[model samples]
Target: MPTPSEPVDEFDATSSTAADPVLPAGYSMRLLDWADLPAVHALENRLFPLDAWPLSFFEEELAQAVPEPDGGTRDYRVITGPVPGSASGTTATGTAVTGTAVTGTAVIDADRDAGAGEAADVVLGYCGLMCVPPLADVQTIAVAPEAEGHGLGTAMLLWMVAEAARRRATDLLLEVRADNPRAQRLYERHGFEHIHTRAGYYPGDASAQGAGGGRVDALIMRRRLVG
Candidate 1:
């Protein structure tokens, strides 16, 4: 609704003592798994209908999470909060799922563990990063409408920054829509600076743009992690 943009946040990668973001109580973050694909895909379509990536896209990205001879190239995380009054977790397809929580972190796998109790977890936000040595790219990041205003966005961003640094990346890059100043400011606050603009990079609806369907420009921003 705020003019679709590839949103991002700031991080002081140069500082060794940068504080990790603290999530609000009752919410937990963990590595994304196959069971989350349906929910994530639904959220993606809801948040960015015009340019939402297909379910297959997410599958491919997750597949790269596996360790290769050259090390894994993808990292994805999901934040989930309890669903009030729900007896059990359900995937997007309405199938029930059981998860195990360990020290404030929950692991949701595709297979159900009998007698795991009735605690339903809902995906509130998700983020992905691609790190390949000298460069890192933010693939996607989004938070549910109801989860906005909290620190979810910033927390996820900090995770990406830390992961990129761990992979020894020298720079981080992302694209934001030119019309979304809020997202731009967030990135700038974390050390990202606009370097280029891709003209008419985002597609717009024909009804909104009149006949030809005007496109939106994308601002390319980068944060240098090292000299």
Candidate 2:
């Protein structure tokens, strides 16, 4: 039994030739909102069909973090691509607001180029983070199948790291499907190292994960946060 903290390098890789959507100038990031839930849920269902969380979870997350000042609404933003040359991603340091009570879901997006007619402000991807003792756990990250290679996942992860730092998190941990090599590469690029493995982590249909999937393993990964 290996501890979930041991670091290792090397992963089984996958090669899928997929084109990513074109993005516009100055991609922006902001908190997610209730209105964006439908799109987010759609992407999640597509990306994690086997283990998608119930819709109720989404509603609950948002409800929990609602700010009381204006009646139970969370401090979230629906990141829309700002006018080009307009500061869409710009935010004042330390003034980033949080919900009155930290009970609901917080959302954000990479939506800088959409308004320029270069891309739609649809959620090409999203990452979830939750604070725990010592570190922030990356709850999950999923990108639309069509948005695969646009580096949206990487941007989301980095944003989460910054968010975690704002919350005083010291490290980050996440579990990856054993068969997802491309994702593993993305994680590696972000300084995440394999810490351990979970056997039979993902169940597969015989059509896809047949004999080749027998050795399916989930990789537990961690990245140390640095100032």
Candidate 3:
């Protein structure tokens, strides 16, 4: 494990997830375990208060982190797999969930200096890529306000790029609030080009104007993943 104060990879964006999907070079990313829920939940709630999914949702995701050793991962979350109508459900509030975790995988790893016990996986700054056959999305990447600088966000994005490519993902996609220029810049630096935009995407009065008047837009960005 690398120490917190150690110098991180400045442009360490290249990594392969074929055999070893663990963190690349200066950073580390690992499969999420049941114990990581508390920290993940706390970050989700804090970074995305209006959109954070419930605790039960996290349980289901962790449960389906990978395919069962005997057979396969259950499709209780409509994540993928051949199930007649197996599909993850979401509330109007932007909470997408699965009754059981998806059969695929979920991963997390932060700076070792982020401290151990609970805070380790809390995503002081982190990124995730969800692979569900034929599609892969940069599910989420967040950093605590205090960790904003130090290039943690860029490192996380590079990790996701490597993960998506390893999954043989055709295209990598993610949606960021149009209002967040800093995030957009980070995405742009890593070959993500804007593909589309959604009007009134975020549902909250995070600004003084309120949800509609101060409606936030979501920019859907994409990066091709092929040789």
**Global lDDT scores for all candidate models:** 0.66, 0.51, 0.50
Q: Tell me the deviation in Å of residue 78 in model 2.
A: 7.1
TM-score of 1: 0.74
Please, what are the lDDT tens digits per residue for candidate 3 over residues 26-60? 43445555666676667566556556668797677
Name model 1 segments beyond 4 Å from true: 1-20, 68-70, 83-120, 211-213
As for TM-score, the candidate ahead, 2 or 3, is: 3
Note the residue pairs that clash in candidate 1: 10-190, 11-190
Model 2: per-residue Cα lDDT over 50-90, one tens digit each: 55767787777667554333343222223233322223453
- Per-residue CA lDDT of model 1 for 119-182, tens digit only, reads 5467878888888889999887776654555667667776787778767789988888776666
Q: lDDT score, residue 117, model 3? A: 30
| Ten residues in sequence with the least summed lDDT for candidate 3 | 75-84
> What lDDT would candidate 2 get against the real structure?
0.51
The TM-scores, one per candidate, come to 0.74, 0.62, 0.63
Sort by TM-score, best first: what order?
A: 1, 3, 2
